[model samples]
Target: MSSPATTPTAARTPRKAALASWIGSALEYYDFAVYGTAAALVLNHLFFPTETSPGAAILFAMGTVGVAYVVRPLGALVMGPLADRFGRKFVLMLTLFMIGGATFAVGCLPTYDQVGMLAPALLVLCRVVQGLSAAGEQASAISMSLEHADEDRRAYTTSWTLQGTQFGTLLATAVFIPFTLLPEEALFSWGWRVPFWLSAVVVVVAYLIRRHLEEPPAFQEARHEVPAGQPVSPLSVLLRHHRAAVARIAAAAMINTVNVVFTVWSLSFATSVVGLDRATMLWVSVLANAVALFVIPAVALLADRVGRKPVFLAGVLGPAVMMYPYLAAVHAGNWPLIFLFGAIMSGCLYSMANSIWPSFYAEMLPLPVRVTGLALGTQIGFAVSGGFAPVLASAVAGPAGDNWLGVAVFVTIACLISGGAALTATETAQKSLDEIDALHSSRTEAAELQALGTGQEPAAGRGAEEPAASGAGR
Candidate 1:
């Protein structure tokens, strides 16, 4: 029996939690996407100035974009536990400020002409801060929204966290378009700074909205159950109880390679190699992501109804096949085909996976370590795959930059790995977090008993106990 205060019906504020998650993720990703657009369009020239080869500069700038991702795993180790221990709102507010401050600092940095080698050094530092902040942002937002949601609508509610990301990408690219078209000198000197600087305004707005968000009832209940002065360590629980779940999530997150390739690498490949107009390349992302803003929720709604695995596997595999055609359209220099394929690949196919991953991944863990597991697992996978995807895609495309086939093959392989991982997961969308935890316990006990070749049934409460209990809600 649950107390009225801890009851799901009484305590969950699904709409408010979803709204906070949506806005915070939007702002966080806007800061992130702004950096990606700049990396593709301008940062190479400004920060990583090269004397002769433009290819080296492009690679170097893309490398800095990956730098944030490289640091993200470390950030997850820190922020994940903090969020699980303290509260989701604390991590949300803290990360919002960290990302906003770092992004604003990027806009004010001196370029290579003014500061020589020190210019890129500063840019990398700011990106490090952004990475650390981003490591926890989505995971906490998802946990907050998921915990506040009704059992039947968890996937749909958590989908808004990612829905916000689509809006952010759309907004970032749209905002960067005019700046991309500016006169070369002015574009390099001042125009690029505006977008990064503008993150400040959104940060304040997000903070105001997020400040009033109540901690979800599930989290509050779990905290109350802990003995005073004896805090539970999420990392310990995670490593002891959830290693397989973490590994599965890390592999599944490789699906983000599709997103990275679509958003970052393709932009660079089209403009730098294929010699397409920069604004045209940028708009392809803008328009595709604009459609994705709508497609994401629809896909999430479908996930809730159909099951996470089918929708997830479709998202994973659809991009694998779509990669070839999308890149071919870019190579052919056909604008209509580019827009058409880009919209289908990014806007429709990729949205299916992206919108539901927060819930899909989070549902695999119990309530106590949900945020930590989600953060560490996804960050590790994102760093390994999505983080380095641009540079890897650029490298495989060959030095001549005409090898579109190799890039497509690379994306296909990554997507397949993700889809295979998705196949191993039990369908979690149809179950409550408690049911998921009990299933994990029973499976673990079954495995242990099987190893011993015993016919005896384990004690009823032995495998499924406190700290890993249903009361802890994942």
Candidate 2:
């Protein structure tokens, strides 16, 4: 019922939500990415005793990094329904507190020398907490932003949430550069803890910004439309009506593998195999992320004008093609080439997909199930893509190996799968947010009507076949 004039004003809600989403996502990923940086460069040395087989120790350390992702699906199942039923703001707040608290706890955990094997076990427990919080954070934030966005501008506005994530990555890498550069003795004992402890500052700032946000109006309307005591369940509705959307989202979600490989595995590859200093890889991460801050918003603007699918397709295809050259540069020990590859692949090419996904994924669902569908679908897909990317990348590198071709092949396949998924979705850029659910409802009703008139039974199987069907087409 929001008019075009009022719709513009309502869209301002996304801008507000974007601000909150940006800060919260920035803080959360800062904590998370810092851990990845450490896992790649330092954790094995600190947690595992110096041994002849340093590669195995590094692999074990990276496994710990992947452990958090193992908990993501559970977090999605628990928190997705909560966001759908309660409010986006509530879930956002809960995730921020959990991520921040757990990150801070990681800083305080005793090293292996102090606590023996118990130290790594405790580290994994805290990581699970971080994973659970993260599972719902991006989805909830995107839902909040997308629901508040105006139709034509949705991609641009929601892109800010993604921009925040890149900012977090940049901040995380920037923070770790100095720590990694510290004298080995200092870095081993206390310097690594500084980045984790810094989560306290990010958490405090994000909490204050998010506390003032209001729930999206679409959610408010959905609450009114559903019958009282009818046990409205977003998951149930999503499974029943939005199965195609879920599949599309999962396929599109595979693009995250590009990010995880670059962020986690590249760091390890560059430092361990390519013989680049750990500090150099961290600097590359910082620069790539800084570039992403601008590239993401620019690609998002282009998506709004040209349509989401084309922009998304370009993002997906660009990375697959670029993966070989990028990995090869690192293998050849070309610093300039390494920076160029990172900037283009991670910063510019991948940003095209990263920036637009908040709007693209949210648009695939109706207001009632938007949060649950986005969270569950993306998190489930990300479990395979992001969680195991490091392990896969390591496996490809093999024993006594720095196989850049193998890494490139792995990255290319993931990107192609994501592109194929994007091609299957309906174009939704021109439609209003509030009308999306209604439009979908009308389509469903019309399809049912046409089936009945053609002598086909309705799929739902309970309603009066004639009047309801006739009225639907009208």
Candidate 3:
């Protein structure tokens, strides 16, 4: 099945794949995460009328932020299968351009004063495209990176994608902080649009970097393994065989709610409700994300040796305990306490789960359905929890004041859900590609498929006796 022309180029270099994944994710999320800051601070007034109460406007704006997540599952449905079938590099470039165009368009939209209801309508439409772009970005990037990695280093390699996320957040808030210091008149009028416009620059930078990357060898081998005129459908296979994986992943994915609460909702709460200075809240994002850029990679290295479950579970429980104090610090308007607690909760503890989930979730799936499975399961959970969290948090805090108790309880429950769900998965840190693939497919099936193309070793099956990674069989 190997064509002489393609074999040498088929397997991407792990370093190239990982670096491309990192920059691509950083650019996509820079576009994605900046919307949260805008929703909390700018969009409420520019897109929603002053006639709406401030709290209601904030809720409406946050709802627009959620709109992308609401439509994300739909995006996964469309984009996931394409990546699975067509190839990861194609979908990766496609989303890069799509999100770039959408983010730039957001900078061009007319405010409520200029265009009335049409402004928010246009904003939602742009968010929809962005939602679609994001749906495929992570799944494809993670799948590509994970496949390229050697077994011992997969968790560490894939985590660079999420490290890119921290960089994206850092850049978004870094751009936002200076704008917030502008005179209120200018800040509300033009200051806020600068970051949105800068998305175009990041887009060009990412596209130039990403276009040169190759598809992973395993995906190419898997594609070649199928018989002529009988190409397997990734979606059909996923729905029929991996429903349990989907469910487990969705539950584990709820950890995103903690992130949403910390990054978007908490920032809004501290500034709007507790009257903490806007600059101070932005610094929380800056510091936490800055810390995470370092912390996530370190945790990923640890997960590589010890296994993902313990690190992921620790990430879950740490935040469940810490959310209360973090919110309390915000309410007290104690700047030092807010800074300290925010760094601990979001920067350090949360980074552990954030880094590991890329490999933890990806390895559970077979090569054929991995991209689709990762995309759909995570997007569905995110649609319900993270998408709704900001709107729900604004509502729980009431129109006029802080409701730290209600908000804290909401985050804690989400953490517990993610932690409990993670326990159900088998630890995958030490497993090879074929061994991991055999966990879901029959051993004979895995070998027969691989033999048709790559001619690698037949799987010994997922049940083979061997030394277990820490927290295996939990």
> For residues 222-322, could you state the per-residue lDDT of candidate 3 as single tens digits?
55542443444667767866888999899999999888899778877877777778766877878888899999889998999999899999989998899
CA lDDT of every candidate: 0.83, 0.79, 0.82
Q: Residue 242 in candidate 3 has what lDDT? A: 81
Which portions of model 1 show Cα errors greater than 4 Å? 1-10, 39-61, 110-120, 180-190, 272-275, 391-400, 441-474
Of the candidates numbered 2 and 3, which has the greater lDDT value? 3
Indicate whether candidate 1 or candidate 3 has the larger TM-score.
1
Off by over 4 Å in 2: 1-12, 40-60, 111-118, 181-190, 224-227, 266-278, 390-403, 442-474
- Angstrom error of the Cα, residue 391, model 2: value is 4.2
What is the per-residue lDDT of model 1 for residues 1-474, given as tens digits with 9 covering 90 to 100? 235565443378999999999988888888888998899889998887688888999999988887888899889999998888788999999999999999999999999989999999999999999899898998999999998999998999999999998888778877887897889989988999999999999998888888888888767654454233334467876887689999999999999999888877888889998999987887788888888889988888899999999998888888899989999999999999999999998899988999889999998876667889999999999888765787899899898988989999999999988988888998988788667755665443432221111212234554434332323333
lDDT of 1: 0.83
Query: In model 3, what is the error at residue 150, expressed in angstroms?
Result: 2.5
Model 3 scores a C-alpha lDDT of 0.82
Badly placed stretches (over 4 Å) of model 3 are 1-9, 40-60, 110-117, 181-191, 225-227, 268-275, 331-333, 390-409, 443-474
Backbone collision count in every prediction? 2, 0, 0
